[model samples]
Target: MPTVPASRVPRRRTPAAAVVLSVAVFLGTVLSGCAYEYSADHWDDESTSAAPPPSTDAALPQDPHLNEPVTGEELDDWVDAVLPDAAGQVFQTGFGTLEADEERKETTAQLPKGTYALTLACRSTRRVSFSIENGEDELVDLSLRCGTSRVNVVQLAADASLSIKVDANAPANFAYRVSRI
Candidate 1:
């Protein structure tokens, strides 16, 4: 059988530099996550950006459901894949009796639309990012390279609220959000 060239596939519109950074983030963050080493170094991209802190009295969801946090497993499912080295290192620590809210949805929080902020507590700082794709395969691949990964989540207001919760015994917890400048 004849083989098709790798170039046959359309390239992502994301800049090559951005792809490198995103991959770096995946390699740096996911490896630790899969190793069960909780860390926030993963959000070095999101935590360092210009996203400002939100006011407590700012807009909020009338539904208490929005106030709830997103779980690690939920975030895991959204992750399409990981660095080649991290593929076999996934370590899960299950402690909850309550099931994840499957009906919950994600509304892109990046500005000028709106920024999404979330909190993640872990034993290390190497866990970062969310790659979500709808039917069109338009994926959200934030990385340290594009400078969209490091934002103070609590200060950012999201069009739709989401969260990432590690076990309480985990090391560090981050409260972050993504929104327009």
Candidate 2:
């Protein structure tokens, strides 16, 4: 009897059969776990799956001018209504001061095309940051100290409107002075 070398043995290809069998086994295993009935009556039971009808409460009145841009006079009136003491304060090149309570308060003014300095001094017991915005954009965001002042200079190439908004993290009373230089 002649002994054949190990390298001379023919290797039969079974990868295709193995792959097909593996895929069939995997699909059978997955499908066996999903044995749910497909009947409309199974899901249409009123007692088990009925949602309550929506409440028929009266609709709230919507503001007509809610999306309108605020005019200078309207902004002035809003400031006076919220912070009555700060009303009628002029924001000229001189000095103007305003007090802010726990609620957010705003002051709006029209600025000419020039460079001007702004000074903000707030006496806040709680931590807070004041925001200066032009339209929807924030120009200055200042973190106020208890008894200190911060100053910033802004330049306007075109005539624009600006609004100063005071916000406190906690309930606080803050007195801020705005001076133009």
Candidate 3:
């Protein structure tokens, strides 16, 4: 008997059967992973597991290095804590001079729409706070040195004037002078 070639044999192509088998295999695979119940009585039952609740312990504390407020005894305690027991701090006392360019008469102290220049010098053993108040005459006052060696230079508005007195006895270590330029 002669062996027949596959191309010559009667080919029975059942497209419907292949399609049905493929759909049935796919449905079986997909349904295996998922599930559905048909019993109406069991559908209402709730027997599934529940998730555990979250922990509610104490909260973490904040760091103490962030510039805590010091007052009264606390300030004294802090000064004492930081002060070294040894002597010789190399304390130097001197005067520093500053000048403002009179050409452009304006400053960034948020001065009003006007022409003005004011300067003050303070000589003291401690620092001085600067303050600026807005009004008819923008006031500038600086805590001066102990010797009261504070000088104030003022150039008022065009036709405007001010009575500025430079007190040289504020006793402050640092000299702070502000001028509108």
Q: State TM-scores per candidate.
A: 0.19, 0.41, 0.20
For model 2, how does the per-residue alpha-carbon lDDT over 22-125 read when each residue is reduced to its tens digit? Answer: 99999999998987677776557566666767876578664544322233565444334433232223354211223333446566467666765565544335
- Local accuracy by lDDT, each model: 0.34, 0.56, 0.40
Clashing pairs in 2: none
Which parts of model 1 are misplaced by more than 4 Å? 1-125, 132-139, 142-174
Model 2: CA > 4 A from native: 1-101, 177-180
Candidate 1, residue 82: the lDDT equals: 16
lDDT of 1 by residue, 135-178 (tens): 33433433222112233322323223233332221222222223
State the local distance difference test value for candidate 3.
Answer: 0.40
TM-score of 3: 0.20
Ranking by lDDT: 2, 3, 1
Poorest lDDT segment (10 consecutive residues) of candidate 2: 92-101
